[model samples]
Target chain A: MDFQLTDEQRALQETARKYAREVIRPKAAYYDETAQFPLDLIEKGFELGLLNLAVPAEYGGLGLSHLDGVIATEELAWGCAGVATSMIANDLALLPILIGGTDEQKRRFVTPFTKELKFASFGLTEPGAGSDVAGMSTTLRREGDHYVLNGQKQFITNGEHASQYTVFATTDRSKRHKGITCVVIEGRPKGMTVGKHENKMGQRASNTVTLTFEDVRVPVENRIGEEGEGFRIAMETLDNSRPLTAIVATGIARAAMEHAIDYAKQRQQFGRPIAEFQGIQFMLADMGMQIQAARLLTYQSAWMLDQGQKNTLVSSYAKSFAADMAMKVTTDAVQVFGGYGYMKEYPVEKLMRDAKLIQIYEGTSQVQRIVIARELLR
Target chain B: MKILVTAKRVEDPESKIKVKPDGTGIVQEGLKYKINPFDEIAVEEGLRLVAKHGGEVVVVSIGGKEVHEQLRHALAMGAHKAVWVNHTGPLDQMGVAGLLQKVVEKEKPDLVILGKQSIDDDQNQVGQYLAEWLGWGQATFASKAESFDSENEKNKVPALVVGADNKTVRVVREVDGGLATVECQLPAVVTTDLRLNQPRYASLPGIMKAKSKPIEELIPAGLGVDVTPKLTVTKMSAPPARKAGIKVPDVATLVEKLKTEAKVI
Candidate 1:
């Protein structure tokens, strides 16, 4: 079992880590405070070819391996999960098009993304359908050459910023999941109105808002896969994207753990460094253990998918394990920091807040467990 | 006009170095290497000049086979081609200047651009020595990016090629007190400073294409120069630790201590 990263992968990792230190990490706090999207950094990511690394070369992307994307994402997330989330969410939107879109459709939808740092949302979840995809209330009605889209999507990331959206809507609610269709909305279709921006506890650098679509006209050609195929497309896209969430969780875990350890080494209590205490040491040890396991699981899932192996089970494991691990590790990190960690002045609190969302988004830890259990039953 | 830029791969500036137990040298077990920052600027400057004056940019490096990676990086930064001069042991500034002098003779580029100094060895001597060996005028420690007329030879001068290709260029260099601007004829060496220009990241497609670019490796022994070290480091050690300070009880006591004990008023 050769586990060593290839030289090219190592180069990708180094480049990203360097960028994280030099660019992202320094501005992380500022962006988080102002809740401003880092457009320049996003442009820089495009220049560095960090955006759309997995998309094919013909479509103006690097055609990099899935492992390379995971490595890059982890390094960036190490800097700041909010900025990293905003960055990776761009790739999240592209995965569906790359997976299920026809060549002509890819040319129409994904090619423009390669040239710029424009964002796109993965629009499966609505106000009513977070975990239950079949329960999504958004509807699409056929009108000759176009489908009229109407829906209310809540907690949608990059709602006001994305030039396009990979939105899912049911053609027939009676048919449930079988009636779902995935459609690409280009440049914010005329009838779509972006609603109020939501102020979240963490990952604030990302723009999260409500999207209101009123009879938005989308051409039939923009549909990804056949009608009723949206459910599978969404599932497969999540399967491809779940590892990214795990990588982000691992990043938050590592970042918080690192700050806690550094603080511990220097912070003195009772005439000795807090790190000298076995209790603090044990917390650090557990933090380290959790991060390593999450990272390993995340890497294994990404690698399996890259090798064209089935990854539903491992992907769920990574997402579930990493989400829970990040929460525990970050909370412990705050514990290691004492009262200072509870304050906003310290970074551990922010990490703790960010770690909570990982357990809730993409797929919750419970949802992931359900998938894992299904695999076991199968 | 043909522009020649020198590329040097140095240990990553961020990595910490520790003297060996025997006090010989720092551990090189897992050192990360990258194109020195100044050299990256030089390569970028060379690319910019070539872009403005329609010429081929050739990047050259004197190192072992491993330096090919850096050379490819230079090519990826948009250099037209690259040359690798192989050497095994450490060489003094003069030795490196002499080897580069051989490259100058063969390539005979209209202009030679190099970093003011390598970060690994902060000796700012190669650019001067190289120009002297080639009997060409040089401008060292060039001022930051600014565009001024060549007529103001005492102020900031941008390294801009005027009429004939990259033949006649102007540069303003950092001087003892202020700045000195120089307008040198063709075949002159210009050592770039930190502020010349920010180096562009090598694009993915460019890097992929850089792999196929020709890199002609030459043996330094055939150049007929002694590539021997003329300097020695008797020992190596880190800087001394900084001492802690104590707080004074009052301003009068602090003043008294500063005047009598610390000897500063």
Candidate 2:
């Protein structure tokens, strides 16, 4: 099989990489330190069409392929995973509507985002449920021409900033996954409260908070699908998103490895560059090898989705491998820098911090392992 | 005004360059290529001119198939179309000017903008040569009225003021010490300096749109231009590495060394 990206794909990658280097990398540390949402860069990203890659062309969005999305995401992540997460969160938010909403719903909900710079968040995780989707305590009740939504979605990305939210809540908790319903809530309703931004360990540039929706009214027209279909919709969205997550991890790993290489070549020990030592070289080699493998796997999974192939198993493989790889690579990159890596003065420490979340979010490494084993057994 | 802009593929200035062991040329392997930075400025100027005045910016590049990358890059940055002069051999500035003269005869653009010099060669002759060859008025080293205001530069506000008559344009030229303003008539050639404008990045949508834009290919033979080089480099070599400097104990000693050993005084 040929590995060459199409000319258009190459162009996409180049554009994203250039934007990442020129606009995002310089401010990454500042955002990380202050834990501020990068609104200015997000506006620039909107102008550059980096924010909404997967939305359809009919709705005034790029309608880029899954492969194109991941390709661009990798470069954006290389700049800073936190800022990249903030940018890609829009894709995550809109995927549910794209996958399950009607054409009319897409026209009403997705088209406005294309015309201006705006934020939207995917609301799935709750205070009670992290990996267990079916066990979430968020509730949705049928009302006259509207659904009453009451939920506390914690660790929600773009929670405080988003003007729109695609939230998942159950209509009947006893029915487990079958009871879930997906609804699009635009703007804050009467009783909804956005909590303070979480002081996260990594990826702090992405705004994460607890969303408390008390009797938030969602229009009936905003319901994504049948009551029982939210589980399937969320799963499909994650399947589409997992490859992108994997590539983001790959980007972080790549950046860390680059920093390690540059540091190793210049750093001296025993009157010679540390790079001359086999210990450092092998670490670098391992980092390089794993990064390449992760990148290839990520590309393959994303390509499969674009080709309309079922890629759940492969997505899990890529996500788990790339996440674990990033955590290890960034940690080793810190080791390469010795004591300098531990300080805020150096970049590797931030990268090491950033790599930790990739292993834990979008289904933790353990959850991904479970999926892989389940898929294999099936 | 219809504008013709040149985009020359050159080694990226940031790439670590090494002269080949044979001393014939640089090591091409693993070297990154980009559109000449000055040429990129020229393209930006053309686009800005067209943006306000309402016309097309046609970008042209001369090289082998690889130069298509440069052409596409210009297109991605919002050039209307491209003309590729497909030839893969040595050509001096004279040959390049001669070839462009042929393309100019065909396209008949009102203005032709080029980089003052390609970074790789620094042979700032092609624009002047083409202007003389075409018997057109020329403006070289085009800059802004003052030190660039970053906001205006980022917004790509045109530095060159086109006369209300539409047949003349006023340009700020960067002379040896200061700026000189000149007004040239229509069908003129202008070369861009660094301060002309800050070139815009090719947005993702622009890149995708560029993929569908047409690129017409021509050859030197097809244009009836003989590309025999009048200027040839006999050999290539890297500059000598800079030596470490010795710190003097006192200002008097530093002054003495500057006057005698360093020979600055």
TM-score of chain B of each: 0.90, 0.95
In model 1, what is the error at residue B66, expressed in angstroms? 3.1
lDDT of 2 by residue, A255-305 (tens): 999999999999999999999999999999999999999999999999899
lDDT of 1 by residue, A155-222 (tens): 88787899889999999999999999999998877889998678888998888988889999999999
**Interface alpha-carbon RMSD, every candidate:** 2.3, 0.9
For candidate 2, what is the lDDT?
0.93
Model 2: per-residue Cα lDDT at residue B141: 94
lDDT of 1: 0.86
> What is model 2's C-alpha RMSD?
1.8
Candidate 1, superposed: residue stretches over 4 Å from native: B145-165, B203-206, B245-265
Model 2 misplaced regions, further than 4 Å:
B145-158, B247-253
The model with the greatest DockQ is 2
Residue A230 in candidate 1, Cα distance off native in Å: 1.0
Candidate 2, residue A141: CA error in Å? 1.3
